[model samples]
Target chain A: MIQYDKISSRDAFGNALLRIAEENPLLVGIGADTTKSMGMQKLSEKYPERVINIGIAEQNMTAVAAGMAATGFQVYAASYAPFSTLRAAEQVRTFIAYPNLDVKIVGGLGGLSGNIEGVTHQGLEDVAVMRSIPNMTVVIPADAASTEVITEEIARIRGPVYLRLGRGAVEKVFDAGYRFQIGKANVLKADGSDAAIICNGAVVARALRAAQLLDANGVKARVIEMPCVKPIDADAVVESAAATGAVITVEEHNIIGGLGSAVAEVLGGRRPSPLLRIGIEDIFTESAPHNDLLDRYGFRPEDMAARIGQFLSSFNSKNEEEA
Target chain B: MIMKSSVAELREAARLIRRDIIDIAYLAEGPSHPGPALSIADILAALYFRVMDADPRNPGWAERDRLVLSKGHACPAVYAALAGRGYFDRAWLTTVRRLGSRLQGHPDMNKTPGIDITSGSLGNGLSLGLGIALALRLLRKNCGVFVILGDGELQEGMIWEAVMAASAQKADNLTAIVDYNHFQSCGGTDEIVPLEPMRAKWESFNWNVFEINGHDMEEIVSRLEMAKRFTGRPTVIIAHTVKGKGVSFMEADNSWHQRIPSKEQYDTAMRELAGGSE
Candidate 1:
């Protein structure tokens, strides 16, 4: 039995920020009245001079962060995913991205993590919105450990970055010793590729379990963890597709412009292969428990395993017909 | 210490800057916001020529006071002042809106030296200024951030948000100047959206409000000095002036807000600004 230590990505992000602040005194934190929720309260308390709560004004907060960046301060602005990535998107695009300021935007409660709050709070389309902006680096950590790694990495990078964090605790996908690199996908499990399950954010662990389930069913599936969605690892994607001959992309976001779309864009242009996107269709999610919502959206490990199996079976039959 | 320039000297600098504005507008291909630019010539003159601690040769000096032209469409005024102050060659002023020119239609800090922030979009300057003020405070730098906002830009909600935060933080190092020409694009400010109770608005937000005749060089200099002295809160200088103050035909006319002057109109403007053709 695998021992799983679970912690919220928000807590990991907050802890990482506190650690980062101790080393870099020039680092400043700005919040849009979401200090506690976005895991920035400890930083605000410890470094009161460095942390600024700009009330509920996300737009002003974003611009202020940019202004701080212009003055040579490494700034991180945090807010709810919807508010930060959508409400203040124009500010992010104009002030931070256009000027290419070194501002890191921390988006909390991405996707169905805010499931209990319904569509209003759920950040279903944040990835799509942020990925479209020029000069923006979009990162979604798979678990608490990766969240810490990603937080530290983005702070070191000298440009605009969007770090998406989940609301609740999730099973650990990587150990503390796991090396994190920007724009590189981590392969969690690899075997003879009947199919490859590419996933990111809160769904990576599930994809791993789905791969195990596929193994028991006599199908060898590879699990690839894509943390950086914008500067996507195109080589890893193409290699996985070429080796497996089938690809399944899973994300806790809309299927349109999330990791699935990013992977499709890479493979569709460079290498053609059978691909299946596993994510929320074009629709709003209703209020429910987080796990239940994941299940309802066909994102549970069992569902992923079943879907990948079906896709592989069809893929094999098609190949057989061609042969 | 406040730098001083005689009213006559400041007046001459303002007139020269106005001529430069017209010259640049004439050279540009499309319409530029010359009326608003001409309106603030004296204010810019008082700032660049007298008040501001900036060196044109060293535009990126760390201790230098920063200026954010929030009312960005009126960049002709800033561009001309920068040129007159020797931040760049005066010859480059002719390429205002030309392709690949550092002098973009609006201010871009990365592209242009001496521009502190990129601000063509209205209502973003004050917030950006506040950020710089906070940064200065954090670094213990004794520098001030001056933001020039358009009167019509007051309609944007983000401006008020920034206004509230600057006072709440007690950012004494920041000063916001409103170029209240009483006009915006399309019509008079009253017909569009009145900002008449502007003094009360800033005061209510906990800012130190100073009302002055923007065209008067003396008032512009003194008020800016006063704002620098007042500590523990941000200041807002409401400079009342006529739109297109230098030119007779363009003065107080909203249609001239963004209209490029014809050859005859440009000649008349230059002649009037050059002290009635010698």
Candidate 2:
């Protein structure tokens, strides 16, 4: 369990990176003019010598970070999710991932975290682009505590990693003393489940809330928080599917290639189940409040609760009809 | 003058590199731009054999000088020099673009040894080299970075983007050489993109510019030696040479950009390459 005040994922990344930088002098923080946006400014201020502010060149910044990593420096290149994952993808592919350089790419405002920044700012396609690259560890933290913990974990591990952190405040999912294994999924609520709600990133909190709402309506729902999207815990996913017979994956990214897509891929090829993937459709986002955007994109807790109710009702009707 | 023995060995290495180019192209049935490679044969030989401090056994030496072959299609020459320097088994030079060979049609850094950056896409090498130069400078490493850009490749907008950044950063430890072979794959560079006043263009970008006859061993080595002594800004060596220097039928022929020879033509080319005794 992480013993810290509830904070946003981006803020947690900021706080956690500062702690790691204290011990590792080789750890350098670089931002493509998004230090404050990604909450890397804290790390910058704490370790001024280690932080490199590369004005506004995202492409140059990525290549520069890769070069630094090649020369035996642990580099964390920070920027918004869309820009870091897509805008500088070629650089990440050629310099960082292909060469297997030690670059920790911290992408902030994943999914619709930057609600008001509109569709352009939303990173619905970030996971799709990053997960395709070989030797890349794709991580989407469920909340601030996990984000901080994962940031510390990747700093110790070598190779390229893409850590997605959300903007804005999020509810805490894990309690104090919860150990976060990098590629392991945390089963938040298990047993006595009518359906399983599997989610990642900050959307896990919403899934948890929806589970609570389902319990209030006489439906037991198990909420699972899957942080590592690339090397997904298939055992956890299969166990949830086996226990509940139906699974719902919630996330703030695009349904095409985000957490839902990853889960569907595992579930489709392995033990198949009736899986509902809740996320942004294949559409661009525009500037709006983060919460309002979440609501509009059908990712709010209420939306998730409604979806669970529909799945449970349908499952019950099918069971009764069989009887 | 200072490193007499090394320079003499490099000259012999240059002759071998020239011979390897003729042999590799003939074996693969792949016609490369021979003039550019023949002209740059001495420089490549000097760098790999004498000037650049590298480890063939340990290609990943941190302090080794970085080389980016911006004109990657000229790998026939580069592969020859790399083999001459013992970066890989010299026999591997015969499998230039064969299946499962480390050598690709273009240089792949992952597959090939001593290739600092993967570059087949023109206009990307300088930027990649710039990244390496900047990274080394940031780490306070005292190693030199070298990039060889083709004259035709200079037409790419990314090259200028890199030029502006290199100049702005004042990367003194980096040196860029333009293989001014006067011809591109299509035709003469002037007829294609018209890059006249090449030296002035580099100078305007705040680079220290030098022009030399690329094939002349003395000028090529002297300019490279001078580049080390001068500092405060990056240096660009614009080496002028004919397109296909050694073979009479292929000399100044743009058709040889990638045109392989017939059996008889191959024999003739070999004869011409071996001082035309046949």
Candidate 3:
């Protein structure tokens, strides 16, 4: 059993932004009538003038943030995930990504964490949209600790970044002193050789627990945490796939375009390993409790463990038949 | 710093920019939009020559005013003005839209030295300008931002969002110049989308509205300067202009909106623009 702390990545990021603003006078925040809901309440309270609530206009907020970035301000444009990515899609691509502005596009309530709000609010396809845009650095921190570190790290990056954050208190994957770097994946558990569990965002800790369960069942699996979705750790992915001979990618997003596609792009005929992708399988999710949604979507620890176990058992059976 | 030029000098500058536009169109390996470019030449001449305080030597001067060419297709006009104002060499103007040239079909702030924001996608430029104005105000920097808009571009929903937000924030340091050339890529804005009651619309939105002849060099300069003094709300100058102002065959013609001039047409335009001040 692993100890877990519930910390919302959005809150951690907001707190880190407030702390960062203390020294950097040019830091500006743009909100789409979500200053409080998006975790910028504390920052707004402390420095009310720094945050501009654009009042439910996500597209305008994005371009406004891009404009602010042109003036040398490290800017953050925060809105709900669906509206930020889908509704304001062209603005992000045209104003920020094409220009390579230093504007950080923050989307709160990523994935099933916006479960109670249903498909309208959830960001099941944000990573896909963001990854497809040129010059966009996509990041989804595993937990609050990683989120805090990533927020600080990406602030120093003088280019466009999309930092997706979840709504609920996510199960903490890293401890207090976790170090993070953009485009690098961290291996949490390396004692396994049967297969590797590569995941990002809040699902990282669940992947670790699934790995632990795999260990108990005499099936060893490696757990790798991939935070940066774009500029991915292709070297780690190739090596891990080559070492374990199999790869399973877990994300809180659509399996079609998120971590799975990224990994597949990296392993395109080079590794030639069997790949299994687990996520919200290209369907709209109904409103429910966050954990129930996770469970239904096959993101729970036992669900992943069972699925990986079945897949491995089938692979072994095929190999035995070949032998 | 502001270039202190007389009205005659500014008119001469506008003619030169118009000539530059014709030159680029003639040099084009493909078709280009010379209609919108021709309309905004005088306005760009007024801003770069006498009204706006910007430095060609230091394009990134923190204190200098910035221009967001919101209607980015009119960049041929902007490139002409920037070249005339010494942002870059006049040689690059001939290389417009050419492969590997810094003068792209649209304005790119990174590739080009003096472009404040990369704009071409309409209805987003005003917000970009508002953002810069708000930022400069926060830093207590005495600066202004000019956003050049197309009348048809006003039909975009995001433009109204920026318009309302700018007034609500009381962004007095921001100015938006609508090149009301009465035409867009397709047809006349009045006939197509019809942004009529235009003045009342902006006034209702609480902007300091000023109507001017966009082709008038002195009126353009004075209205731009007055925008800086007008406080408590953002200023918008709606300048009425012709689609293609100078040449006889192109004036008020929708056919010329996005058409690159043919060799004979280019020679005719150069001749007309050369014999200026009618």
Candidate with top TM-score is: 3
Interface RMSD of 3: 0.7
- TM-scores of the candidates are 0.96, 0.89, 0.97
Model 2, span B122-230: residue lDDT tens: 7667766776776787677788888888899998776776787777778887888898888887788989888988988999999999899877777888888777556
Docking class of 2: acceptable
Every prediction: chain A TM-score: 0.97, 0.93, 0.97
Question: In model 1, where do residues sit more than 4 Å from their true spots?
Answer: A1-6, A319-323, B1-4
Residue pairs clashing, model 1:
none
**TM-score order of candidates, top first:** 3, 1, 2
Worst 10 residues of 1 chain A by lDDT: A1-10
Model 2 gets an lDDT of 0.79
Candidate 3 residue lDDT tens string, A1-323: 55555658888989999998887888988899988888888889999999999877999899889888988898999998899999999999998999898999999989888889898999999999999999999999988888899999998888999999999787877866888898999989987899998999888888888898889999999999899989999999999998998899999999989999999999885677778899988898899988889888898889899999999888879989999
Q: What is the C-alpha lDDT of each candidate?
A: 0.89, 0.79, 0.89
Error of 1 at A123 (Å): 1.1
Please state the error at residue A272 of candidate 2 in Å. Answer: 1.2
The per-residue C-alpha lDDT of model 2 at residue B171 equals: 81
> What DockQ does candidate 3 have relative to the true complex?
0.84
lDDT of 2 at B198: 94
